[model samples]
Target: MLALIGEALLAYVVIVAVQILINDGLFGLAKVFVQRIRDLPGVDLLIGAVIKREADSFLRQIDSKRSPTVEMSIKIPEKGISHDDLREEMKQLKGEEVNLDDGQIFAYVYTAQNEHYKAMEDAYLAFTDTTGTGTEKGDTDHETLVREFLRAFMHENALNPIVFPALRRFETETAAMAADMLNGDANVVGSLTSGGTESILMAIKTYRDRARSLFPHIKSPEMVAPITIHPAFEKAAHYFDVKIVHVPLDSDFKPNLDKYRQAITSRTILLLASAPQYCHGIVDPIEEIGNIAREKGLPFHVDACFGGFMLPWVEKLGYTVPKFDFRVEAVTSISADIHKYGYGLKGASLILYRNSDIRKYQLFAYSEWPGGLFGSPGMTGSRPGGNIAASWAALRAIGQDGYLRMARRLMEATLALRDGIERIPGLAILGKPEMTAFAIASTDSHLDILALADAMEEKGWRMERQQFPNSLHCTILPHHVTLVDKLLNDLRESAENVRGKKAKGGTAAIYGMVGKIPDKAIVDTFIKQFLSDVYTCKT
Candidate 1:
């Protein structure tokens, strides 16, 4: 009887344990589904309101002592204002309410000088009211000149390069130019993408498709990259259903090549090395990683979106930037943005492959469409030709010598800022930055990096806060050279002001919370809700 009772108790305990485990798993799944449901259009507003309220509350606390407070006025005007009146109002707001011209902001305005600003404004005005038909027969009118140029240069559709001979030529020429800049030969080929994100997406998608084709038995395609690599790769993995293997970086923010190599397997398709990554602005060990990729016969991608234009110029300016381009034997591809450092309009970026054969994989084509066969080289179907014209114009106008001069000035300013930050007692620079972008963090026990950022914001500085290390980040531009000392002074004062203040709220707190959340699904749902809210316009 005693033995039977003991056996019954054990069985009951095992059953209960299994039931508990099952229940917990179901609960987690249900939570994810609920969060996703909340992210839908109608429901997302509630989440957004809550988040905005939280952020606003935090901002108020941070700016309580400041005279001109950071506040949000969400209500629309009762009556529509004239364009001229609105422009005047905006000017007044800037002069009276908020003035970023005090030289505290970073990166957003590359040319803050009056002459450059006026030139850009004029360029914008010249094209603002123009409209055009297709490229042919449109060059005579101002509205159609850009359109005609684009039509003459490339096809309306990027996918059908054969049908659009001009697009093929333009793409080929652009790729060649990029490859030459990177020290590659005729074997190099690439595609023009919308931006850095699309370029990354194409690379990831190509690798994923190629891996599946080659290794039919491997269900999951994996990629290895440093944690500091741009978040776009993570987004790529999410979209394409590939597993990501993120390797940690060294103290200097460079990737550990050995660990990266160890992470690689037969199922691995690509390895990523950023030429001065976004967070701390430290270049990875690209040569070593490229060699590894060659030995393993894997495709290596150098993400030079930030450094691509600048690094080449910096090299010409006599800076010892590491080799991170097609010149490296294993670097099969690269993504470089013209919008950021290239001084072009937004929405222009390029992705280059080692050769046409490899780039062919990025193309999407279908003959069964009712619209007489459909194909696209990159992501977009009908890209605006105006953007292309502007990008081409900016590149030609800047020229090589112009870029080199800008690079020299920017580097000097960056060094000066670095020196000033180092002089501060409680602040420490993150790593040996290889470019103009760098991050600063607090070494003092009581200092909160986010609080410091908030304090700076109160001073009309729009600095970005970075995670992984909790630091204040900046991306310097050519125009920032004149205001570097002013920025340094403000930063020093802000640091001192927020020395003992706890990080309360704002982007810093939100990101800090996001980092702590173990389940990424919930965080993703929250972010989706936030984005949906941003797009939601009340009637």
Candidate 2:
């Protein structure tokens, strides 16, 4: 046991070493080893070919194929095109895009109806110049309050409260409203962030800073979390030089509380739980986890980014949602995304702490620069007022009653989809989902899930494909209710079509190639190259 723990500690030191080395912004240095592994004789290229087919076929499945002449020769125009021409070019760029309006794709975009998007779009246009002027000429209309926020380039720097009063109010009131939903009183304090990932990053950073302030000599700080916890935490661990200790989930898809509690060491600074984790949508036993955190005197962060806006209504609508909020005394902080279920515009999330003191760590008020006093909250310097104002507008627009109605409709849809998937002969849900998002695995040996996913895609319904358990993921949005009948029909057809038949291509091929790779480090190598390809442009 001591040896295993020693290994974990040694690995953590390496992580911290890399963090120190990369401090001067040698970000690519991080991917150095992963890329080198890919270049090994029996790495991605050779190993992938041995797994299935020729070099070209395996390369295409991995998306490792380089650009051809046409794409490589593409060049920037000397002069900008007209607005109409630009819009046309962008449309052409999509080639044949999936119809998101018709509920053709799941996972990313969350939409209910056309009017919902229309209202947000109109709200966005209302404040086209979201950071135009710091001084506010207030508009009496409520939505113009959104525009009032949008019209000014507002900085919520407490150092210059005189310049932007409305922005600060927007941030405070937005946090207050979210706090109210989470059963918080006046004591709860938080800041608006770019998105769920930023909210998570801020929470991790705050606790790390807090630990540093409290125990100045503690160099090796670690966080305890479930394996199902989002990748954002790993990113946080990498960025903040903190060691994250992850434990596996049990059969019920919750973290083994015994193992979780046992994993806590002297260096442990924080505990983490997720409200309906992104993968299987199974929420951890946060109340239990928080209790342990309190016993240990550690900061407990509940990542409710996916469920924060949605779960309150889910519980209200008579679903068996667990307690994971400010209501739970030991839940010291929570990260929630307003855009996801709050139906706010994209790029808005909130990280809430129990009080101002705890939240202060996330706030950096530095007089380091020559320009008077420059202090900004979170990672971003000049924050977008539009995200803040739009969030406020969205919460107001969809009041409690309105949200309840939306929640009811989505739950019903989710239930229908879940039932349909279960009824299908070969497919089975990974676990009993407490929320709408879930993954469906193939129980029948003959059925290939990735092949079925390909079939679904062919039927114009693109669902998120998942790994480890090897399942097809689905998150039933309100728009999904309208497409359910078609979805079920296509799903059934796909199951029948792929039963006992091997997948020729699509997701099956990709996973097959990936599953063959013995080391995940090699997989990471491919991913790094893939991400590099994503940003690579020619000419």
- Using TM-score as the measure, the top candidate is 2
lDDT of each: 0.72, 0.75
* Native-to-model Cα distance after best TM-score fit, residue 208 in candidate 1, in Å: 1.8
lDDT of the structure predicted as candidate 1 = 0.72
Model 1 CA lDDT for position 307 = 87
lDDT of 1 by residue, 313-377 (tens): 78777888898887788998899987777655556788888886678789888987786866777
- Model 1 segments beyond 4 Å from truth? 1-169
lDDT of 2 by residue, 1-539 (tens): 99999999999968965875677346555556556678787697666557556645754653332222211101112232233432333234222223444655433234465687668666756554423111112313323443433332221232232233334545777788888888887889888988999999999999999999888888999999999899999999999999999988898878999999999999999999999888898889988998898899888999999999889889988889889888899998999998777766567899999997798889887675785666667888766555675565556545677667777887887888889989999998887788878889999999988888888888788778888888888876655667878888899989999999777775678789998989989989988998899899967
